[model samples]
Target: MSTSGKKATATALAQKYAPQIANKTVLITGVSPKSLGATFVTAIAVSSPALLILAGRNAAKVEETTKAIRAAAPHVPVRFLNLDLADRESVRKAAETVLSWEDVPSIDVLVNNACIIGSEYKLIDGCEAHFVVNYLHPFLFTNLLLPKVLAVKGRVVNVASDCHRWHHIRFSDLNFDVSVSWKISQKSAAHLHPKQNGKIYNMWQAYGQSKTANMLFSLALARRLGGRGIVTNSVHPGIIQTNAASHLDPAEIPRLIEQVELQCGLANQEITSYKTVDEGTATHVYAAFEPGLKDHNGAYLLDSHVADPLEDPVAAWGTSEADAEKLWRLSEKLLGENFEW
Candidate 1:
């Protein structure tokens, strides 16, 4: 169980665990400037890991992050891995490239952190864009790279969120097509509505559904890796200023902010009081190095501690064993491959 209170900062944790980070190879996706992933890598860079592999879709953005890392720690060895989470083939190629890299050691910390946030309805390869990019692709990439992670008995960190409480998986209506989504109800079967009400798709719910999958996927992977000395956990990096929500209309920003505050019980505080990018990166950095988490595999971390279901409603629903297995099967079905491991 986790206690509720102030959280540790990423820089402090990195300094405290410098030796542990020094010998490990870390891979993180979505390392764009001002984003959580970039901040996370920056924090890790100071400690001089064996190798820092930054991955993303844009070469320029990844280069930008690489420059920042160089400035922070010039001697740190950093490499770029071209990864486009929206494209399944790109993910496969990225994983294959990693597995084939003879110069790099086994991945000691695999952080599936890149994600997109928006209200618009779009599809990738006939699946919902949010579902595909946020959950499906990372799911594929992680499983494909399991060999590297397992070789070092490394841990996995899935950047999930508290927003998951806003909606269920919508198993029957994954795309949230207005025509099909309207059919779901609170009275629907467990697979259709896991504690969520019957409602049409909205920007919040769409993002929520994908985030829920992140947590469930963490649980499923942990179960499968039983007794393997590998810890897999999900984290809710606190709300912070980032470009993730750029897809939403500028005018809708305030409304979206207000909604997030209210839903996450921060409505009483001002927007400026939201966590800074470095602060938001704390729990992620903490999760990556915290040795105590080995006994708490499949846990959801928040504010730099394992989240308590009593303190956060999302914890219980996000960790449902049944939901985890269900989402795992569906993910395999969507990818047209069964991961026997």
Candidate 2:
């Protein structure tokens, strides 16, 4: 499909799902202005959800998003909560606060939209920063709030990326401590390669692996929660111009863009295929409320529909029952909390 066609389809899906948001209690993470999360919150607010919780690490940023949503949606109830995904304690406290809410009956939707891209290497609980911020944190938070979500048979929309095509889970050395050097000859193929100077950590590889984790988590969660009436799905929101790339060095942007274009096999090298924030966020909105998706649990969505794993190799790996189960077990070990459900 052409870019314009994709955009139109996304807009139509958003409108189609708008009515489902009314009176639903929705909680979304990562709502900074112009970010995908903010776009989801704004689009959903039009339908006047009963309560909208905007979560992020920065209180001021969350407040700014809240103000914008309120300005556009004066009647919608919007609340902001400080949620630092890198810290396990903060995630726990935030989940506790939501669980303690006296008036809110149930959470209808939980959008794990918060994620980071290129950044210097760091560790949280002995895990890579991208892996923790993008995958583990969401895993912990979602499991923590499972009871509330189950109460309403809610949906969990994980904002994953098609960038998962670049890498798969590095189970042996997830932190890049031992298995650092790697190469992606083509966008679809990536593997470890010995470096002359020893291990060399690459931020892009870390980011790609983290995204793969998102898909794996969604598949595993959906399988586990399937019979419980709760739905879980991951979405590749397409490439979009967002602050997600703010951490990238300015000189690297052009090269990265060119590489992405080449990998996507776009004929016009001069024209990038990035989507506007609205079009990029539409799949997330669609995945969160599409009634037909109830039977499509554990599915990965692209362009607002269930994507074929055969079309994307990384997605195929993510959907592997064995890999998903391994990831789930590893996550439980890392978090020190075994989820019963």
Candidate 3:
């Protein structure tokens, strides 16, 4: 509600916090060419961070992001680590690699930005693909690297989304059967094609649940690290046309929006608008380096400011303390590790 007229642009914030970002070691996951993660890397590269580590599954794509940063900011140091979010061993290996770097002992900023948005039903290590790649693995990777973050009393930014308001954590069935029919209004069902009418594997809704988990995870970590001086926050980077949405057919976008509106009980209101990649990266950059946010741990950011639930229409379920604690326990149980902060 304190937000004035327009959101602060990434360019302005980068310049304002150049001193804070300079010489700070930053690590970001899910970096790839033309993606939101890559755009975020580019935005911060201009500030000349001491180190920038890009983590992702595709080595070549991650390299592309690195090359672009090199071209623009030749003096900025950049590194890449092979990371497969769906694989527990790969996530652990990536963390170990960062820990072993004698030259770079601590990570000043860690951005868990990698995610998959898909409608297909697939399992990775006996867990649903979206939940594993988007939520569980990030949870595991962050916990593994907590020591590095603690070394400098750094910041952790989880790139969540406003779409999280669409669904709550399906605690009872985190791996719900996507093939089953999802009950909804007849009007909302009318928007889907005949074949997709009763299907519950709606890509956006599934993605929403994972993003909600991201917010909850940030809340839980912030609570545990309350006075340790390590700031943790979730961000809703503006909507953008990136590779993350490649699974969705372009032609179906309008109908999909209609489905979302109908399901959320918002009949005719405009729900979203597209953003340029740079525009989309503003909030992520804001959450990562903005000195003003040092005292606002566990905050959810939108448009480069702490989001107010009253003004933003963010669902209470996404920020529920009870749900955050429950998800934290579930994450430790599923990973078979105690991540005591």
Candidate 4:
């Protein structure tokens, strides 16, 4: 839980439960085109599973990603499904597809790796972008697919991040109507460049919010699912610059100072702490198919190993009956009662 900007300095990861992935079914959650999602999907495909599901919202993208997976493991069983975690109907349909698998093949591994970075305070079916993309989507997808995953007593890997430390859930205003961002004001004062303008405003704040939500969601999931023989843990996939950064509208435009004060923005650095797609998927790949610590069910990992907090145990969240109840109710509100759990 060390939130320092530094990537995990330690190299050792916990593997007390290693060797549990022999001939197990693993699902990479975000196998979209041109993404670390594809990288993870390809890596796992090479492992040769009984069944591989390359899923995403884009049909062509899924086809391309699955094609890459197929090229890597020509003989491995693979299927591509267009899955939109942000949409309830799409999620439900995906569950049906997953449940209809032949022989009801157990899902041994699941990576909740889908994410989006939006700063416009947009809403997806009334849910905020950060909360919806980072937590609720994965939460609903996991809950709906539990039956398919539980049979194998699978491991659920959540791709969280240390940037989470930048902020916490403003429970009151999860939406940005009144939320804070570094783009316009710093401690109530304007940023260094008041006259400057950018298409994506407060990109870091939006990202930090989403990242924090991911950790909390992971923590809660780990606690709730750990006792059921399903291993759940979160990992801060080292800053492997994914398309997530491009999610924001990045166009630096000049604007009046007074006008900028109302809606100022940011100009993110072109080069971030990016890693190769393979390197980016290292943490997830280890969590998915690697054999070593298969029994360490409810723990956090960094640098592909168990990352016990160097000092204080960070507060991600706990998935108690009460918390689960709250999360579900809130999700329902976000999606409306018309949506199924």
Instruction: Provide the global lDDT of candidate 4 against the true structure.
Output: 0.59
Question: In terms of lDDT, which candidate is stronger, 1 or 2?
Answer: 1
List where candidate 2 sits over 4 angstroms from the true fold: 1-5, 9-12, 180-198, 249-254, 257-271, 311-314
Instruction: Judge candidate 2 at residue 295 and give its lDDT.
Output: 85
lDDT assessment of candidate 1: 0.82
Q: What is the C-alpha lDDT of each candidate?
A: 0.82, 0.80, 0.82, 0.59
Best to worst by TM-score, what's the order? 3, 1, 2, 4
Return the TM-score for each candidate structure: 0.88, 0.88, 0.89, 0.73
Looking at model 4, which ten-residue stretch has the lowest summed lDDT?
8-17
Highest TM-score: give the candidate number.
3
Model 2 error, position 26 (Å)? 0.7
Tens-place lDDT per residue, model 3, 1-341, is: 11211355666667677898999999999888988889878877898899999999899999889899999899998998999998999999999999999999899999999998855776677666888899999999998998889999999999898778767776645655433237853334444434332245555677788999999988999999867878999999866778988867766766776788578665434636676777777887789888888777888888888888888858898889999999999888888899877
Residue 189 Cα positional deviation in candidate 2, in Å, after optimal superposition: 20
**Model 2: colliding residue pairs:** none
> What TM-score should be assigned to candidate 1?
0.88
Candidate with better lDDT, 2 vs 3: 3
Total clashes, candidate 1?
0
RMSD score of candidate 1 (Å): 4.5
Query: Which residue segments of model 4 deviate by more than 4 Å?
Result: 1-22, 179-203, 247-273, 290-296, 311-329, 332-341
